[model samples]
Target: MGFIDQLKTEYRVGGIVQRLIFWNIGLFIIPMILFSILKLGSVDIGIFDWTNPFSDDFFSLSSNPVDLLWKPWSVLGYAFLHSGFMHVLFNMLTLYFAGRLFLTFFTQKQLFGLYVLSAIFAGLVYILGYNLLPLLVGQTAKMTGASAAIMAILVATAVYAPYYEVRLMLIGTVKLWHIALVFIVLDLIYAPLDNSGGHIAHLAGDLFGFIYIKLLQSGSDLTKGVSGTIDFFANLFKSRKSAPFKKVHRNTTPPVRNSAVKPKDVTQKQIDEILDKISQSGYDSLTKEEKDFLFKVSK
Candidate 1:
């Protein structure tokens, strides 16, 4: 298959995190192509011009009051926007590894929740630092990149699975928590210096991720509120079906004798037991009964 076709196939079968990385890389490439064509025709596509924070079209929540209403969406959109190929590649690589680690413990909804929340917090930190800190340093700046979001995911995954270990190309296997600590420390130390606003943003995202996992462990879900809001709007466009879809109550049916063999019912307790076993001893250690129970429960 051709390169684009291969990418499409990967996107179709890959997890949500991989698909997100593909989409961002794809969007970044499109602008480069457009800019190249414009240059050949003696015209400027003004890609950088549009991206500059000081530019008229630059997206801002505070400076542009109207954008504040739309700023929440920017958290998502900014994740996909990149200035260069290297930038896209670096961010996607970090996302691929960090996301895989994150998914090992978190549900898809929780992963997405952390990602979106991280991006928003990152943007907020950038804005606050640039606007407020400039009073002391007499300088304002703009920031961009997926680093903040990546940091958030890295920290969240570490928080969730501190014992998880991964081998680096040249380095030996290391615990995930150690990696998270390095990033946090780096951001904290550099927040006052070069790319100060970006570092501040990264710290903010990291803080959100850390707090989110803590809340999750206590049985509170931050994502539920965001998901509920999304569902509220989604239901608006859904068409109302006919009343023929009315359901019959199970209580209305009389108990009938079964001729065929019935499968064993797997209760929630059984499922939890299987999960605990898998967590402690790994999936390969499961017996046939446990495997069957897990398969049924998953369905």
Candidate 2:
């Protein structure tokens, strides 16, 4: 299949992780391309430069709390943006790995909710740290990237399955917590060196991830609120599709059923059976024909 068609198919079936990745990548790329074209055409757009997401006042989170009053969406919007190529690349790669690990132990809704909530939490922490910390006094900074959300997923997964092992390229297999510790330590070490605000945000994400899992274990699902809010808004904007018009035909003769006749089309009962099998044994357990039938029905 062509790239766009393949993307569409994958998006339809790939669940929330893929959707999140698509969103981050789209948010980063589309604006860059659009603004580059506009710049080439000699069109001057003031202040909000798409080339540098960090410089964009409208979306990227600022160190000042007062900025939040004006750009409240930045709490979550910043997580979907990146300042540069490497910024987005490593973030997305980590997200793919961490998000998959998280999904193995949690629902898609929980993963998504944790991501959004953690990003907001981290943004708030970033603002608070900049204002309250004596060392950060009189310093102004802006932050952007999915690193905060990605860190939350990574740390949350590790906290839940500390012993889970995964193989690395240069390095051998290591425990999930080992990986989480390494990243957390790096953030701590760099918090005072460079990109301090970003590092602070990462640490906040790590903290939220740990707290999120603890609360979840105690039977308090923090993700439910985020999921419910998203669902309500989704339902609010969702358009109701009308059924297509069909012509009615009357036949004088009655149809006859033959024992020798073979059915060429799939039935609702067959679809339900396949769906039940999927729910019981997972999508990978489906046979080739079953997979094809399901895909066709989805289309």
Candidate 3:
């Protein structure tokens, strides 16, 4: 296969978190590259000028309802745009680490659901905070970046592995929930100082992540429909690749019924793989289903 085809095959098998990171990076870079080419080539269209924040064509969700209505897609688009190199770097890194930690205990579908739902929630929170807060009344700001989504993933990981210890550079070993508490407190403390709208969005994402997991532990899977949504969109765009139909000859006589076979025991290879994942991450990283499977086989 060609390199592009190989890459596509890999992407098809890669989990949702990996796909999200790739999409975020691609979205962040492609706009600027396209705009730069248009500028260098002396394209004088008014749309090229709209790439700036001062223009309405910018991909940022604004605090004003009128501005939001003009470009409704910005609510989701803004989450993939980055203000600076360091901002994107930090956000992507947090997503990579936190996503890995979160996926250990949650399905890829759940991760996708939480990331998207939290972004939409954060955008609304950002708009409401800017428009309704007494000190910030009548103020408007353009919001961009994946910080809110990253915060949701980070807090989710910490909640799932509250007592799990992780060793950090200069910090030695610290409990996951302690780290989450520190972030929550810091965001609250700084909300009044600077970037208040952004902080509010972060807090909103944190709230959503916490609630998502809490409900999930109670046997509610918020992501149950996420896969259906994805499949619907994918099928809409995918080319027809169905296998050729075949007709089979039918037997004249009825076949005798056979007894139902009992399932085989769990294999050593499967247990080893689960054990390896636990060793690399932690016990709290195991999903409830995984825990149940382990319990059943341990006896």
Candidate 4:
């Protein structure tokens, strides 16, 4: 397949990690492509420079309360943006693997909820930390990149499956919590250094992830609202995609079938086993029969 076609195929069939990576990479690439075209023409767009995503007034947080109030979408927009290549690279890499790990223990909807909501939550915390903390009040702290969101996935996976072992090259086996704790401690230790605002935001994301899992374990799922909001928008767009059927006055009752009814032999035990398989491997690892069973159960 051609490059673009391959990308389309992957996006259509790939997991959430692939889609998230596509968005981040796509956003980063667009600005660079624009810059290249402008550079070839030896032209400067000045105020019309859409290439500079960070320079946009909307690409801000509580560092400037007035600006943030005016551009509220910045909270979410900032996560998809990056000020540098290394920045986007690290965040996307972390997200790609962390998402896979997160999905092993939680639903895809839950992962999506954490990724988006954690970024917003982290941004808010960054703002609060900037505004409330006397030491950070005078400093300029403009946040961007997907670090906070990646951190959330990292922490969520660690918390959900603390003892889950991964056999690393040479290192043999290591627990998920061990890796997660190292990152958390490093952030905490480096909070007083330069880029403290970012470290603070990362810490906030870690906190949110742990709390989210804890609440989930306690029967208080924090992701339900986010999941519902996502479904609402998804269905809204899906509704627009389908051609409407003309209403007929003489229409009879809709056909019914045994499809709505489940076989008595397909017990909850079977479902639990399928779910366990998903947790150990992934949804993509499910057989065709398993996939069909899941689809029917979902319906």
Among these predicted structures, which one has the highest lDDT? Answer: 2
lDDT of 2 at 191: 92
Give per-residue CA lDDT, model 4, range 180-240, as digits (tens): 9989999998888778889999999999999888888899988899978877998899899
- Tell me how far the alpha carbon of residue 151 in candidate 3 is from the true structure, in angstroms, after superposition: 1.0
Provide backbone clash counts, one per model. Answer: 0, 0, 0, 0
Q: In candidate 2, what residue range of length 10 has the lowest lDDT sum?
A: 260-269
Each model's lDDT comes to: 0.69, 0.86, 0.76, 0.81
Which lDDT tens digits does candidate 2 get at residues 1-299?
Answer: 47786676566557678889999888888888888888889887777675774557787898888998999998888999888889888888999999999989998889889999999999999999999888898999888998988999999999999999999999999999999999999999999999899999999999999999999999999999998998887766653453357688998989886766445433656766876675445566689998998788666
Which candidate number maximizes TM-score? 2
Query: How do the residues 22-113 of candidate 3 rate in per-residue lDDT, one tens digit apiece?
Result: 78777767766777778779876574442542234457888887777778998878887776667778888888878887887777777888
lDDT for residue 21 in candidate 2, whole number 0-100: 90
Instruction: Give the Å error, residue 254, model 1.
Output: 31
**Off by more than 4 A, model 2:** 237-289, 292-299
TM-score per candidate, in order? 0.70, 0.83, 0.74, 0.80
Q: Which residue pairs does candidate 2 place in steric collision?
A: none
Question: What is the descending TM-score order?
Answer: 2, 4, 3, 1
User: Candidate 2: what lDDT?
Assistant: 0.86
lDDT tens per residue, model 1, 1-299: 47775565455435568767877777767666765666778775554453332222353223222455755455456655765567778888999889888878876556667777788777876666655665324454444567787888899889888988989888899999988998899888887767676677788888888988899899999888776776676665554433537787667688886756344433655755766665444455689987786565554
